[model samples]
Target: MTDTTSVFENSPEAEFGDYVALLKPRVMSLVVFTALTGLLVAPVSVHPLVGFAAILFIALGGGASGALNMWWDADIDRIMRRTRNRPIPAGKVSEGEALGFGLALSGISVVMLGLAANWFAGAFLAFTIFFYVVVYTMWLKRSTPQNIVIGGAAGAFPPMIGWAVATGGISVESVLMFMLIFMWTPPHFWALALFMKSDYAEADVPMLTVTHGRKATRTHILVYTLLLAPFALALAATSIGGPVYLAASLVLNAMFIAGALRIRRRDEAAAEADGYRVEKRFFGFSLSYLFLHFVALLAEAGLAQFGWGGW
Candidate 1:
């Protein structure tokens, strides 16, 4: 069938699942988890119901951003294998509907967050949605290889927003949470780019792998991995970290660095011929890497509650 044919069949009303797909549920889950970590670890406290509301709004904002992103990137997404089946690209949702849904949800999330939590949290949520949709998807993705590196700021805002919901503002502690995700985005995305080089090349996108070649991408991975280590440790040094964080950081960082080093050692042909097992393994591990770090932070928060451990 033609692309137009596919697009029409994929509208939100066409299938129950298409609507959920538009929200980018996987991304929302990560946002919820990280934001919860931020709320739980913050020095201040929020009522249980209010905390739940804040996280709910944050999740809604994240979904809004994803819908907007899907609306904007529908054309290229249709062409790329990795995103070809997304609700918009597959014809389950029209661009206009996605845009309207996203705009409405964005406003609702921000206003509701303000009423349920604090204005600071609400403002931060608005900014995150704007940055992700306008800054990252519209402006950055196709403009430069540094897109994920810099645009990562959009994704990194969740935990900070969560912290603000509790603490009513930013702090060194909250900023450290932001830094961990910011540093993590590059290697995480670049690994996917390495294996999906052909998808980028087909779309004429300037991913680091496409622009600089896989060899250079591998080198870049190692460099970013090196940079990631210090930031991870620095988070441990902040008020967020404790014995649990220290131990988690040490092991996760060691495995992450070792994965990058392995990628650096493999030639492009070797890496690809093995179906990018190394890159894929690293990508898989990176997911665990982020989750473990946040869980470690949660552990630290629990420990501090008992006066047993804290930064």
Candidate 2:
């Protein structure tokens, strides 16, 4: 079947699962995990129900962003092999339906967050959705190689919003958490770009690899990985930091740096010979790198609850 045939299939009506897929549940999981870590690691304690409600609303806000992003990027999604199976591109859901679903959830989440927690957190959620949908998806994704760099802020805001839910304001610790994700994003995405360069090129997305070439992208990956290590280490020095986080940071950053260096050392011929194995491996490792760092933070929080965790 032709690509158009696949995309325009007169398939059965979209099932509930198709709508769930539009929310990008995998990405939402990361948002939920990081946001939960933010809430749990805060210095102040919230009532259990209030804390649960805050996280739920924050998660809905995250889901809404994903839906809107998919809706906006549907054209490019249809072009890119990896994204071709998404609800919109697969003809499982219409773009208009996705847009409406996203906006409804966005309003519900923000307003409920305000009533359930505080307007500060609510406003932050609103802005997170806006940044992801309007700023990154609509503008930067098509405009520049630095799209990931500037757009990374939207993904990094979840922890800050979660913190606001607990404390009603931002703090050094919250910003540190944001920085951790921000710095890690370039290397993480660049690694993927190294392998998925063709996808970005075909979609006219202007990813670093497509615009600046692979060697520069590799160099950039190493540079950002180096820069990310210090941020991770510095977070371990904050009020949120402790022995657990420090030890985890040291190990994870060391492994991450090694991966980046491996990718940086290889030429395109070598990468082709190995089927971009090193780049793909590093891309896989990058996911675990961010996840483990926050897991360590969560462990620190657990220890602090028993009075064992502190600087």
Candidate 3:
């Protein structure tokens, strides 16, 4: 048998914060927000305590996925300037500890969600964890230029899981929410890749910018931004949609497309000369773009209580 001593060797003593870093808190926040939006916008109502518990469990599950991703990607993380300080990469947590923490949380979160909500929602969460850890992190991230394109589905599932928490099933509204994130992910990550310099290339991750060239990646960002518009607009016609969402969708999509157009038109010389200002600005706007769209959905949901919301 192979000697496994190094695999389980203890690293430096880890702090509470280091362990938390293993959870990728920023990504978990997005998961929580989108999931909460899905639950709130659903036609069915959940008791406050149950809704709270469901969201908590869902957030835990998302964190579990993040931990597992960190465990698996520890090597890549060490090589990338953007990720070198992560728990495992920084020697603050052992791979074994991260793997164990992730697995324990995964089990607890799935079981608690099932008890708090419905079994279907629990199963969906389980599948999401599996997809992110096994499918996206393990399989796609290193192998293909289309990793973010296909792997984006794993991130897109949170809102649907949230919708299921209330309705205990799927619907057009939940699906549109899923599509909105799914379509937006490629352009969002691609823009980051555009400005990230050689992180992906040095790490040997097959990002579009690494394998296909920046020009192709720029074209892709434009294409995805254009494709994303329809889904965002279509959600405005759903039961959960209203004037607020429609107006937000129109303006955000217009601005997003304009950003993508500017990105596509720029060559490397121009981008490098300006320090990738356009790409960086586009990336920052993409975060606000998603957040504002969801906030508009929440606003519409609130307005519906006063009979001023949906069409």
Candidate 4:
């Protein structure tokens, strides 16, 4: 007989490292970098210490969202090969402890950001956390295959929030940054979904592949990739982008689009037989695509400081 009684009693007590793992630190790195880019590119200048504080608080908010997500998704995560080993699902942390930790950090991050930066940035950070945890994790995740598509907006908010920290307001540039990430999310995530469809199927999650089949998912990836190219290029037309950003966008999008096309051309059997190697490569390249784009934007900003590039 399965021992179903008082599992918590035997479960290891949650530790500091487990709590940290709940935060998904690697994902938080991208959040910090993109937010810093937005802050740097904004026309307004902030004190270095204040800018640092704002980015730190934004990162904490990202971590809070990640923890909350892990807490909520622990069930499906345990069933899925990709997420089976996360802290909560793998028995490293109790769900209750994760929930409490996430909630506390969410509150602390918002209040600290307001005190250290501005209320506008703080409020946006708060909303970002709420949207990710409540709107995305609680509402959208289990309900629809469009989960990542809509949930991506939460991830897209960091750069805008950082821009708000510097300018104390929103603008086209910040919105463009948000749009870039927003458009990038579908293709990026769908590629992984293509390669790992079995995991989602086993977890009973309504990922695109689970709800719509690999062929349909591949088509959707291609469609989103096509849509994303313009946004990637459009960023280069913004005040933030210049020679550096344009060059990066051109090269990255060319490769990304080509990869998507290749995926579209491959039959499911061929893809699976090869362990979806192309999809995996595309997924890895997509990570570089985003980071390189942001780095290019930063380089342009740096160049403009020396009167080298800008509108």
Highest lDDT: which candidate?
3
Q: For model 3, how does the per-residue alpha-carbon lDDT over 1-311 read when each residue is reduced to its tens digit?
A: 13455554643779999988888899999999999999999999999999999999999999999999999999999999999999998999999999999999999999999999999999999999999999999999999999999899999999999999999999999999999999999999999999995898899999999889999999999999999999999999999998889999999999999999999999999999999999999999999999999999999999999999999
Off by over 4 Å in 1: 1-12
Across residues 68-120, which tens digit of lDDT does each residue of candidate 4 receive? Answer: 99989888988888788899888888899888989999999999999998999
lDDT of 2 by residue, 1-311 (tens): 69878766855479999989988898888898999899999988999899899998999999999999998899999999999999999988989999999999999999999999999999999999999999999999899999999899999999999899999999999999999999999999999888887898999999999888999999999999999999899999899999999999999999999999999999999999989999999999999999999999999899988999867
lDDT of each: 0.91, 0.92, 0.95, 0.90
TM-score of model 1 vs. true structure: 0.95
TM-score of each: 0.95, 0.95, 0.96, 0.94
Q: Count the backbone clashes (under 3 Å) in each candidate.
A: 5, 0, 0, 0
| Model 1 agreement with the true structure over 222-242: per-residue lDDT tens digits | 999999888888888888887
In model 2, the runs with Cα more than 4 Å from the true position are: 1-12
Write the number of the candidate with greater TM-score, choosing between 2 and 3: 3
Report residue 291 deviation for candidate 3 (angstroms). Answer: 0.6
